[model samples]
Structures are given as C-alpha cells and as structure tokens.
Target: MNLEVLSQHMNLISLVVLAVVVAIGFIKKINIGFFSIGAAFILGLAGQMSAKDISKGFSSSMFVTLVGVTFFFGMASQNGTLDLFSKKIVALVGKRTYLIPILMFALSAFISAIGPGHIAAGILMTTFAVYLAFELDINPMATALYAKLGANAGCASTLSMTGILAKNLSEPLGYTGFGTHLFLTTLLSGFVFTLILYIYYKGYKVKGDNPLKLSDIPAFNRDQKITVAAIVIMVVACIGFKLDTGLFAFVAAAVLILLGCADEKKAIKSIPWGTLMLICGVGVLVNVIDKLGGITLVSDFLSSHMNQSTAAPIMAATSGILSWVSSTTGVVMPTLYPICDNIVKTFGSNVSYVELISAVTATSFAAAISPLSTGGAIIMSSYSAAKETTTDEMNKMFKTLFLLSVMNVVINVIMAALGVFNLGHLFY
Candidate 1:
C-alpha cells in the first residue's frame, strides 16, 4: 500500500475502534470523560503515538472549564437557589395557570442562556413544572413538556454556555461573532414556541385544592449560600471582566471552595459526576471524529446547500429533521451559522448581524419533538408515565407536544425571515 493510503487506513481503523469503545462505555454507564481519555490513550498507542500526546486531550481547557462551572452549579443547587426559584415560579404562575407554558418558556430561555447545559435548565424547569402541576391540579406531563420544550428552544437560541457546542461548529466556517446573531434569532423563536405551546394547552382545566406554600420547601445550608453567591458573581464577571466564561466559572468555583463555603469533596458530591464524565467522553469522540475526516463529510454536505434566497425555510425544515436525532443547536449552528453569514456577505445584502444571527438561532425551537433529542426525550419520559393515568390522556399529551414543537419551528422560520428579536445584540 502507498504510504499516504496506509496512514489514512490507520486513521480510519482508529476511528472505528473509538466508536466501539464509546458504545461500550455508554452501555456500561461509565464516566464519559474518563472513558474518552482512556480511549484517546489507547488510540494513541494503536496509532504509534507517545503517551504524552494522548494525555493532552484529557487536560483540555474546555473540559476543565466545564468541570468548574458544573461544580458551581451543583453548589448553587445544593444551597437552594434552584429550589427557591421553583417556589417563587410556582407561586407567581399559579394564579395564571393558563399562561404557564409561556412563563415556563421565558424562564427556561433566560436560564438556559446563562447555564452551560440545557440539561440543567431542563431539570430546573421540570421541577418547577411539577410543582405547578400539583399546585394547579394540572397534568404534570403537559407542564413538564412545556418546560422541556422551552429549555430546548432556548438552548438553540443563545451563544451562552449551553450553546457552546453550536458556537464551536460555527467557528470553523469563518462565522466569527455568531453569538450575537444566534441570540437575536433565538429570542424571537422562543417567543413563537411559547405562544404555540400556550395555545395547545389552552382550555384544559387544572384542579389543585390545597397546594403547599413556598415556606413548605426545604432550607439550604450556609455552604449552599456561598456557592450561590459565587455563581451569581461569576455570571456578572463573565460580562464585566470580559473573561472567558469557562475560566470565570473555574475561578468562582475555586473561590467558593477556598472560602470554606464548599470543599472539593462537597463540590464533587453535589454534581452529577457521571454525567460530566459522559459529556467529556462525548467531546473526545467528537474531536476524534473531526480528526478522522468525519467533519469534512458533514461540512461538505452542508456547504453544498448554503443559499441566500432559501436559507430560512431550508434550514428550518432540515433542522427539524436532524434535531429530532440530535440537538438542533448542537447540529445546526455549526453549519448554518457560517452558511448564513457567507450568504449574507456574498449577496452583499444589508441584513444586519442581528438579522443573520436570529435566523440561525431559531432552528432549535423547531426540533423539540424528536424523541432522540436530549431535552425532548427527558420531557417525554418524565411526563409520559403516570401511576393512575389513562393511556388515552398520556397519548394526547404527547401528541400535543409533537404538534406544538412543529408549530414553534414554523413560526421561528417565519420570524427568521422577517428579521425580529435578535438575541445576540441584546446580550452579546
């Protein structure tokens, strides 16, 4: 075999083996970060690389940053910030039961925009939705779906921590400053999705006679308070200091620990360490796939479709399909952001950054119905099963989510074309 051909074959073999390892790891429910790091080490050896080179991927700044931010979030949750929000949210929305979906979507959007993971937002909103459901005697599944859909929509719309995956995808295509564009489109799209969800759940009577008051919720310890305060300051610092967000998260987490508010033991105990590990592992697999030319195949396929006149509808429709299988923000933003920017620059259209970015972010609101999607699946599984509920009601609630998700996507596509509510300019 030719030397170049041999190298390509070796790389392909490594990719295949890496995929198998990841599959096995997922099956065993292993920590993804550790598994990925281990897989990288094994691949390096198989590919005749030094140990040092393989270890480099494990010590990535991104992973470290995520670890810190996650720790901080855990501490915040432990200290009662999430619980407090849930109590207040339930109380505020209880009187406006009809507007729960809209309220949930708005809150989910803001929270997802700030947090690094949509899963965190989903958990927070879902908890609150459950409380509201019990308080208002509404369907828990419907409320949960509302919260999950809202978080999914918001995740697609922002350039915040949760939207990092999308931002990473946009960078390679020369779409610098995509955050601004994504923020605007996401805001408009979120509003549209919220409206659709509200309409779908309309006329359903909820019946809670005596709900627990806010004081009934559990209290937090002092450590939790310090952690929450640190997180709030960290968020402000991300904007005020113009620091890399991951770095800010790490510093804030470290500060909280150093102040005796929380220690490494407490921090580790607070987070879903397993989930963090899994995401880290997924990140490694993604890196390896990119290195093995998988990204080229995907990128070429997308670049082939970059168009100005049809960008809105094409992206909206295509994202709806892919997002059911993956995160709309995760899959769509990387390719679409650049394509939109290139199309705008190429056409010499006067479409401002705001217009271009909002169109790109609107993709997520449309993808929330796919069972394969992270947020969608969580919503579906959480609310789909009830001990005493009829099968018919369960099916109806699910059908409602599917229809609402589609409507949200359609509305987002229209708004994207119309050039309204660019989040990128508002926050970024």
Candidate 2:
C-alpha cells in the first residue's frame, strides 16, 4: 500500500479504537481512561508516533487543577464545613420545602461561579441536596438534576476551567468576549432546566408549618470557621486577583491540614484521582487522534453532511451524546470544537461563531447529568449511601436519572436549533 493509503487506514483505525474504548468502558464497567490510554498506545504505534509525542497529550495543568480543587473540597467535606453550610441553608428555608431546591441550586451555582467548576461543585452540592430531598420528602432525582444543572450554570464563569477553555478556543477564530457569552448561555440553559424540574416535581405544593429560627442553627466551631475563611480567601485570590486556581486550592488545602481542620491522610486520599486519570488518559488519546488525522476525517464528514442552518444543532447533539459517556473538557470539546470551527469557516457569514460555540458548550455540559458522567455518578453514589434510600428507591432513582439525562440532551438540541441562546450580538 502507498504511504497515503496507509495513513488513511491508520486514521480509520484510530477512530474505531476510540469508539471501542468508550464501548468497552460502558459495557465492561472498566475505567474508560485506562482503556483510552491503551488505545492511545496502539494508535501511536500505527501512526508511527514517538513515545514523547504520545505523552505530550497528557495535560499537566488540567490534572493539577482537578487534584487541587477536589482535594480542597474533600478536606472541606471531611471537616464538616460543607455539612455546616448545608444545614444552615436548610434551616433558613425552614418549612418552605419548595425553596430547598432553589436554594441548593443557587448555592451550587455560586460555588461553581467562584471557581471550583461544575464537577467539584456538583460533587459537593449533590451530596447534601439528595440528603435534603430525603429529609424534606422531595424527589431526589429532581434535587440531583437541579444541583448538577446549577453547577453547569456557573461553570462558564471567567474563573472556571470551562470558561477558560472556551475563551482560549474562541479567540483563535476571531471571536472575542466569548467567555461572557458562554457564561450567559450556560446560565440561561440551566435556569430553563431548573424551572422544568421545579414544575415537574411540584415544588410549589410543598409546605410546612415549622420554621426554624436562626438561633436554632448551630454556629460554626473554630475549625469550621477557619475552613470557611480559607475558602473565602481562595475565592478572592483566584477570582478577584486572578491567581492560579489549582495553586490556590493546594495552598488552602495545606493550610487546612496544618491548622488541624482536616485529617492529613484522609484528605490526601479524598482527591478524585480516578477522575483525573480518566480525563488525562482521554486527553492523550484525543491528541493521538488529532495527530493521526482522525479529527480531520470526522470534521470533513460533518462539513459534508451539514450546512450552516443544520450544523449548530447537529454539533450540539453530537457533543451531548459523546459527553454523556466521556469527559466534556477532555474528549467532547477537544474533538468537536475543531469541527464547529471548520463549519464556521465553510459557511463564512452564514454562521455565527459565538452562537455555535455557545451551543456546543451548553449541550456538552447539559449531559453531565448522565450516570456515566462524573456529576451523575456522584449523585447516584450519594443517594445509594443515604441511610433513607432502600434498594427499590435506589433503582427507581436510577431510572429517573437516566430519563432526566435523555431529556436534558433533547432540550439542549432543541434550544440550540431554535437559537434560544444566540448571544453573538451580546459580544459583537
């Protein structure tokens, strides 16, 4: 075979390997990242890539960010700071059971907007949100959905990883001020989803006569107070001062540990290493795919099949589908953003670059509620660990979460097709 033919075959094989990695991870209950790394090794050899070339795919920055944020939050969890905050918030809502979901949503969104991003915020909020649902007789599925959506709402904040990635990706295409646009689009989508969940769950009907007084809620102890102060400092430094989020998070974690606010060993163990590995491994494979011409093959196919009018929704749907089972930042955006960029170039004035990017971003995040995604898995695990959850209830919640995930994908696609989040005018 000629060199060109061999190259083409390698590209096709890489694509197949990528799909198989996802499939085996889903079906065999294996860590998708582990398989992704294995696939990368095979594809690198097929493409005649050097070991160093393949290793370059691992994103040290992203890995550090994940570790620092998750470790800090984990220490907060260990020290009961998150619990204290949750209890106080619930007490403030006192008897207005309907407000529980709204409050949780707001809190989660605020935390995400400040800097931890959606995954960390979702993990923190889903735990307490589901617990509150059980205590308040609210639908755990609805609560979980609200928590995850709320996190996504603020995920596009300028300080968050999602926002940073979107901004960096958009600027090269001559689309400026995309970070704010992405944030607005994601926030609007999240609000719409939250409203749908609220209505579906009959939140308006919930009421209780008992309203807890402020005094009844426990005050923060010395350790909790220090933890809270550390978090506040992290937010101010990372957001207001534009400090490195990962570095700031690590500093805060260290302070907490040294101050005896959190146990050293447990806090160290609490970092979500598996999630980090999954993201980094997928990143390596995606880089390999790009190197092998797999991305070009896929982008060309999309361009051939889609015009300006259909491209936004098609790409949105594609992102939502893939992100449900893979890392949104690592797999979905890295792979699809280039395709969207190609579409914009192909259609020229016919396409709005900002709108296309926003749609893709929103769609990718909306699917984070799927059980396979980190946020959804956290919710499911939290619910299962709850003492109030019976086996039957757990099964029912699983079904509900699955259905909700599907609904979110459909809603995002429709929203993108209708240009509901067309915020290009806001930036331009």
Candidate 3:
C-alpha cells in the first residue's frame, strides 16, 4: 500500500511514464508517436525486453490494423458513396421535418456498423442532416441537432470503432465471447436510443415535397456511383460477418481504389492518418508502459487484497474513465482487459467473463457522447460553420449535441442496470 513499494512495480512506473508522455503529446499538439515509442523503449528496458521485442512495439501489424482500416473509410468518402447515401436519405425525408431525426438514427446505425469508425458514421450522418436541412428550409440548429443525434446513435452500434472497448473488457473478464455479446447488445441499444430521440423530437411541421420518390432524385456522377456500389457490397460483406472487421474495411478500401473510385492519391488524402498514427503510437506505448511499470502487477496485488465482490464497480468506473481519456478502443482495451481478467481469476465467481466484458463495453461506448469525449470532440470539429445561418443558430446546434450526449449516457447506464441484453453481470 505504501508509495515506496508501489514505485517498485514495473507496471506502476510504466503508467506514470505513460501519463507524462500523454501530457507532453497534448501540449505539443503532435501525434503521440514519441510518447508511445519512448514508453515502449523504457518499458522494454525495465521489463527486461530485448531489442527485437522493443522493436516489435512499433510493428507494422498494428499500423495495418489501424491505418489500413482508416484509409478505406476515407476511400469510401472520396468515392461519393457517403454523399449519395445521404442524398437518397434526404430525398426520402425531404421536407418531412419531424422524420429527420428518426431517419438519422436508422441510417447512422446501419451505416456505422460497417464503416471505419463511429466518428466516420457521425460525420457522414451529420453532414447529410445539414443537406437535409437545406431541403427542409429549417434553421442550421435543427439540422445540426439531427446530425449530432445520428453520430451518437451510429457510434453506439456494434460496428463502431469506439465499441472495441468490449475486446479489452473481454480479456480481463476471461470472457472469450464478449465481442459477440457486446455486438448484439450494442445493436439493440442503438435502436432503443434511436427510438427515444425520435419520440422526444416528434411533430415538427414542414410541408414542401412528397416524402417518397426515388425517381425524382438525380443520378450520381459516374465515379460516385461506382463508389456507392462498392460501399453497398462492403456493407453486405460485413453483415455476412466472416472476417475481421478491420480486414474487411481494408479490403473494401483497396477495392474502391482499384476500381478507380479512389486512386492512391485520393485515398491518401482522404484518410485521417494523423489520428491513426497517434492511436498506433499510443497503443504500443501503453503496452510497453504496462510491462515495465508492472501496473498490472500492482492491480493484481491490490485486487488480491480487496473483497472480490466490491471491485466490480471500481473496475467498471475505471474502464469508463480510461476509455474517455484514451479515445481509441485499441489504446484502452489492451490496458484494461488484463486487469479485468486478473479480477475474474481472483474472484472465481459464477460471473462469466463475457458479462464483465459486456458491462465495460456498454459503459465505455456510452462515454463517447460526452462533450469532452473523443467522439463528441470529433463530431463537434466536423461541424462546418453555416454561412447562411446566424451564429446564434450554430450555438444552439452545439447545445443540442450536448443534450443528445447526456441522453445517450443516461440511456446506456439505465440499460446496463436493467440487464438489457445481460449487461447486469458486469457488476453482479
């Protein structure tokens, strides 16, 4: 319990070093690459890792997993598939002001389940909602609110990049099927949350055009049409659920490029390489820090010291906070999963690992809705300033997003408590 004794643990020291590196990375406004690499090297030395092992910390495999997937999302965007999809949705909802938020939820949930990340889904949906606003003749704030709602709903689904917190929760809970369960539970949650939004924002009046007519919409550009087709095929592939989601995205992206929907130049420009690199860097660094600092060892030791029954809430809260700070599920999962696993082992209770994993996954995904949360920040940043609308309208849009996020978190926590989709096992 003493500070001196805790200081001796490699995981503890590694964590301290990681915290410092992250702080510096933020201050510099650069990728966390240096911090990650530094953490990896220091942890390697402290954990008695060899040069080869340390080198593996920056492995291409990790980059392929993160960056490759991201590029594909970018490729899809470049191809105009997203635009076309949004256009079609807008065409369907045209001047039906009340139905906008409802459609936002449905479209976002389905699209994000197969997209690169939840933020991608959020951005696409929000942008589309803006276009819809133009069609409906609504103020920017209402359009922006629907967009924010789409982002939140879409991000909550199983395909969400943010949803990977389940994987981490699985490792700690000793739950091998956590991913499967979390995926299902999240889908249901998405629908429920969407319904809530739809009901809350019902009955706005606006009559301008017919609600349904595909023939009235113009065809997309040739290249854009191709991209749209490719996205559809990729979505089908993902729903078939045969391969790794990341791999699926990578392949889809490559196919889009090969088909001339997005060339190499376009693909490179489309993707968010900065964010991908940052995640990869932080991910490897966090692993190294854990190894060198023996933070896990200390967690294990303390877990051993506590009543197993009482640690569940603490673990859940910790996972939620960590997920919020790190943003990437990849960065947070590896760091937390092992600790959860240790707790499960120490407790030896009837609670399955999947339950623990599901609990954490549900809560962690919910965290993204907070204004300071990663998904929230991304969505807010993607909001283009409205030239036609007043600044007051834009401010109102931001407030709507904040309100939407609070609703999402409240719904998720309530669902978790109600054992909706067996989430109660997280604490029980």
Best prediction by lDDT: 2
Writing each residue's lDDT as its tens digit, candidate 3 over 285-392 gives: 755655564546756775865564445445555556655555535454555556666666777764344554555555565565555565555455545532454678
Q: Write the per-residue lDDT of candidate 2 for residues 1-428, one digit (tens) a residue.
A: 68768776887878888888887877787777777888898789879999899998877776777678778877877888876776777677766677877887888887788666787788878877777677666677778778878998888887676876665445544666566777889888888888998898887776644244567878998989998899889878976787877888889888988888988788778776776687678878978987888877887888898887788888889998888777787667766776677677778888877787788888888888877777778888987777566789767766777788789889989998887768547655
Tell me, by TM-score, which candidate is best: 2
* Candidate 1 segments exceeding 4 Å error: 1-59, 92-99, 156-160, 167-175, 203-225, 258-266, 269-306, 327-361, 384-400, 414-428
**Weakest 10 consecutive residues, lDDT, candidate 2?**
205-214
Q: List TM-scores for all candidates, in order.
A: 0.72, 0.88, 0.78
Ranking by TM-score: 2, 3, 1
Instruction: Give one digit per residue, the lDDT tens place, for model 1 in 1-428.
Output: 57567566665665566556645643664444566666766665555667665454332554565666667776566556766765556556545456665666667766666663567778778767766676667767667766766666566433254445555545554555556456545555655665655566562354454364556655556776666577567667765665677667767767766776655676577665665555555555445544555445443554467555455555556656545544343334433454455445554554343355455456654566544456556665555433345779667756666666666667766665554544335554
Q: CA lDDT of 181 in candidate 1?
A: 50
Q: Assess candidate 3 and give its lDDT.
A: 0.59
Per-residue lDDT of 128 in model 2:
72
